[model samples]
Target: MGDVVRAPWDAYFVTGFDTCSEVLRGRNWLAPDFAWQERQDDPERWGAVATQEMTKTLSRLNAPEHTCQRRSLGNLFDRSTIQRLTPVIEEHSARLLDDLAEKLRWGEADFVSTVSEQLPISTIGSWLGVPAADHPHILEITHNQVYAQELLPTKSELATSAEATGHLRAYFTEMVRQRRAKPGNDILTGWIHHWDAREPDRETADEILYRLTMFVTIASLETTATLLSAMVGLLLGEPGRWAWLRENPGHIDAAVDEVLRYDPPIQINTRVAAEDTVLAGVPIAKDSMVHVLYGAANHDPRRTENPDAFDIERRGTHLTFGGGVHYCLGAALARLEARTLLIQLLERFPTLRVTTPPVYASRLVFRRVTSMGVSI
Candidate 1:
């Protein structure tokens, strides 16, 4: 439900909300110690997380603060900005498909690492002014970070994530320093100036580096990669729908929206209530965690007709990218990449077909398929 669709309707309406924390994030939303403030007096774990986000502009937000940051970002991320990126998206998609055609000319290829993963990597990297050469590195780090804290994660996976985080932090710090010394017209450079111009010393250069890199790392890599993989797999499963999209090129946007609704990359989002709240008659205590189930909400029969069906012409926006104060910041860019990639695929491989079941990512907060075998 976008805004309480029906009885037993969602309260927060997306993956980023806090109430259903355990259901979505394996976190205790009602834990007495739950705090978004990141107070210094909190336990060691909370403090550690707080410190980690000191430089993360995207993560360092709560309620009104989050709203304001989102607004500021939105000012630069509207339809106009997305429209500007269309040509670039198309160009990148063309190059990627060219590479894919060469590799799979014999009629078989793993489409995940080769296709789904590449779109977001190059798009996100180019937007942030990073060399295309670094796309693979960013993708690897992002995958490790997201998977490390996943349910039933192995000890080595946890350790690898920690190590990746440490190294990633160090890498971004240098990247930021270099960018600041020589400003550019890229997203990261523009944001660094946006913050510095407001308060010259409020946020240190190191903090700027940490936040932008982390956001770009995940926003451009993990979520987009998942959505791309899922869409490809879903299309391959129903060859009829795939063929329809190929014919009705204008329906690509609707197709992207439907894929998000059916198999959202980030399945759940968490948010904390600052005061006592009642959602669908469930009294939520102050500071209560609420997990907004986008997957559940999207499939709720009350809100949608034939909820599970993949309709390329589905109407209305769902809460897959989130809503209100914390809607996704990278949505515009993600949409552009998807359209470009799909367009190129349809134009080149006249007989695109799936040969194997896709391999899913070992994560619940975000679901991604790392492999999909396709035939031309």
Candidate 2:
């Protein structure tokens, strides 16, 4: 068990599994609080506008609105929907792996660009009904927007992020308009129909649709890419681990779960105290910022034996997907992508090895592997 530690910024860090769970599940804790907003260097700048657009996402919305939006978009990612996506995931993974194998013949290749980054973006793009040719453009826009979260983004970087945000909003707005006129078998169309059936007001529905599109696109692209990069780097870090996975292909699911718990992409989630409350014997004033360290909670010894060990067979659940109402909506889709890709990779290159040390991005909130050189 861990004690609540106070930071110089007056924020509380909850690390223990039970304490973090209490904070995450407590109704008194609300997201999109002042903590995240405080990270903005200048609220008057263009970056602030881009940040505002992102804060309108499902992850940042409060109850009632959050509840309704989540319910509306829930069906699209239900178990059956994710299961149906297996073929699509496998197809993309196989195609990417083939390209990777061909490139590896030249000695080495950056797996992050060749496979890790492209797979998730392409898979999510297809689900969103984006034209295959536009997937790269969408990827570039989202990637730029994510840099706004860097600890200290330069003025130029923030301006670039703002420009990208503008482009994304416009593109999705037009796409939503088209999808409404001609519904498709894609998730975006499903979302529009769901919003129309419930929202009744066209303008409000459009706003909701735009924000939902941004939320899903960026979340799916960045998090899944980070996960794939980290998983590959970790598995290949120990040569024996790759061989073990290749031999036990059926363990892919467990392996993915272990990776999520071991080194989650999103390391910390923040919430504000909605009301004065006491957590784990600590008194928290109303509106206090509470930082739930998901990575620390996942590694809590009280929650799992040998918490630091990456054992696929380890039992119990992890806080990586979060818990309670705010649990990750795309959890199933992320797992499906990781599992399918890992299985296919092992089958194609059981002897794959990391040719150089993996490079982790210098960000406190997201565990992103910026580069991982590999060869077979």
The model with the greatest lDDT is 2
| Predicted structure with the largest TM-score when compared to the true one | 2
Worst 10 residues of 1 by lDDT: 25-34
Which tens-of-lDDT digit does each residue in 262-374 have in candidate 1? 88888755555557766555566555445567787777666678887877687744667765444577787788787778778777876888887888866767787878888
lDDT, residue 302, candidate 1: 64
C-alpha RMSD values across all candidates: 5.3, 2.7
lDDT (0 to 1) per candidate: 0.66, 0.82
Off by over 4 Å in 2: 33-47, 148-160
Error of 2 at 241 (Å): 1.4
Model 2 lDDT-worst window of ten:
38-47
* Residues 1-376, model 2: lDDT tens digits: 3457885676788899888898788788888533546654456542376666767888887778788888887655777887778899999999999899899999899999899889988888888888889988987888788766543467776787789989999999998999889988877887888888888899999999988987888889889999999889888876498898788777888889989999999988888887788888888987777788888999898888899888876745789988878888788889889988888888788788999878887677766777889988
